[model samples]
Target: MKVLLFFGLLAIALADNTRFEGEKVFRVKPVLDEHVTLIKDLAKSIEVDFWSPENAEQVTAGTDVDIRVPAIYLDLVYTMLQQSEMEHEVLIEDVQRAVDGQADTGPSPRAHSYTKYNTWSVIESWIDSIASSNANLVSKQSIGNTYEGRTMTILKLGKKSSSSKPAIFLDCGIHAREWISPAFCQWFVNEALTTYGSDAQMTSLLDQMDVFVLPVFNVDGYHYTHTNNRMWRKTRSRKSGSSCIGADPNRNFDAGWCTLGASSNPCSDTYCGATPESEIEVKNVANFIRKNKSVIKAYLTIHSYSQLLLFPYSYTYDLAATHNELMSIAEGASSALRSLYGTRYTSGPGATTIYPAAGGSDDWAYDLGVKYSFTFELRDTGRYGFLLPESQIKPTCEETMLAVKYIAAYVQKNLY
Candidate 1:
């Protein structure tokens, strides 16, 4: 029996070891400060799944680069960068070989099923099933049409009141490669429904506040992620006479529109778009938020693999008008999240947290007087990045619940 069990486990491991075997790691150091921008501009050659400054205090020897990227095009990407004579070394060979050896080995393990890179259809089906079972699901009339005409879905959870209720608007999957973002949205819905009557805080909060979640903010980019490259970020809008496709939807928001941290080049990752809200997906959400700005006291835009909790003023280094209050709330939420598993997450302004990004939804939301606007960068710091394993989903969602509830509870209590 032990022999049989051993073989069974071996088979499962073998089946789940479908990682990037042909890929190679590049331990690169920047010759110029704009080296990252150059590589990002040529993202087609060498793909970067994760990129960050090795700012962690706990640094290992030969790990100063401090980025973990998992992709099939690593070798080709390395070749392209090598041509540029960038100083680099191979940090870790066969990283995923170590990954599967350490990751979850249980029944229905995420490293197993989710490794297949499940499509939007699979996730959409799950959303449909959950919404059908829950009574509080209220979808808005489609705010606008996408470039491809996929109907953008916005779900409002909690029971409807006879009168208006202060709302919290949440959106995710603005950048396509961040698949984990959309998963959190779905998880948030499931929790809200499953815990409605079971959890008092959730019940009372939902009873008072309407939570509007647009599971996938960039529907076209999301669809592109499922169909094409796994690391594709930005929208999927095609510009006339320009070969480049898509704009950074975050850079297309109305506030500060695209004054800084944005690109005039259409192919750039931070292209501000032809105009503010040019991308229909951004337009849709912007219009929806505009129409309901009065009630949206708290706004959250979810992204992944950074382990960050960021608030507004990303376009510039300027502190928000309600900086003190926003900082207080963010600190409390981050502290609550860490209490669970000691999961490490940094809390700060968006510009300081990662990079200064213009036209982001958080900034726009805050400018619109949704002063409690925030952005949650979810899951493992770099181990998984955007390709975070499914097994980690529950834990990520579970720990995140504390922070979310902390914010939700605070918002509900402060309501006039």
Candidate 2:
């Protein structure tokens, strides 16, 4: 009876995983109004997954849209694309194949390695161990719990000081499936601790300013992506009377809450929560920032597969109050990042650079008087999209480190 029960549990676990066997990711370039309309129509008619623009509504003329279409809809999508004569190419011929190839092929190790995409369980253990390993440079505090009861802790990195020191809050993995985001956060923490005394600039920055790193912000959704669906991108909170599980935590912030570039539908990929700060994860971070508003000088949020550095005013086209300074700083940081491996990064405001994404953490942070708020879209232009290989993790994180250090040094110098 016990053997039968064990096999039954194993079957249930295997059944819960969502697989993508023959799904294809396509990059559609719509240069005309009709082409844009056709893309939107395809989304409305079929179960198309928008990969880049976040949703079908954000598709516009002169912008490249990346979407994943299931095997059943392949013939229809091909017909529509050929009929419209829209410029399109298949980025991934087989999504499952790409997903399988993203990770290294080896027995999973118990220890955490910065170059590999670590699971939530592995990351949680690493957080506790890393914080305790270096008491002087690192200390952690749980801000709150995620919707699925995962503890959200922020690792504070800096030299011990007598009085309260100014801080810069950096968070990663807010979108869950962007595995590289959390990887970069882990790399940043490791780099800071490992090169403290040897690297002059790092030593100076840590001596003066505290850098708070949230390795994985959307803990629940991140865990779901690993165990159930590899493409899951939102929280895992269940709402009454609605089958949709989670909201876009990035869009659940209070700034310009759901005004533009966000969907009111609970089923959307960019669903703004029922109300601002609805997701416990967002509220937990928001409350912490509000409590330390005076000392937090800059906010940096990491994301993937765009290779862009964006600043405030994603909710609207209007330029930020400190637009000139922000642009200059972003340009310099981009240059520093490019110096490492010639990885070019376009730096500009979020709305103008990419698309109008309302209620983003960067925009919210800037509005809350954290003048130096910025969002990073790291690695490839779209060749791999979110399925960036584990092999590129080292170079990606190394180049990004230069850009982040550039921003930190500037913030430290300008602090009043």
> What residue runs in model 1 are displaced by over 4 Å at the alpha carbon?
1-21, 24-50, 53-118, 136-141
- Candidate 2 accuracy as TM-score: 0.95
Q: In order, what is each prediction's RMSD in angstroms? A: 10.1, 7.4
User: lDDT at 363 for candidate 1?
Assistant: 93
User: Model 2 — which ten-residue stretch has the worst lDDT?
Assistant: 5-14
Name the regions of candidate 2 deviating beyond 4 angstroms: 1-17, 105-109
lDDT for 372 (candidate 1): 89
lDDT of 1 by residue, 251-367 (tens): 898878777677767866668899998898888888899899889889999987679999988888889988888889999999999998899888888776676778888998888
Q: How does each model score on lDDT?
A: 0.71, 0.91
Candidate 2 per-residue lDDT, tens place, 50-112, comes to 988999888899999999887767877787777778899999999999899998755374768
Worst 10 residues of 1 by lDDT: 8-17
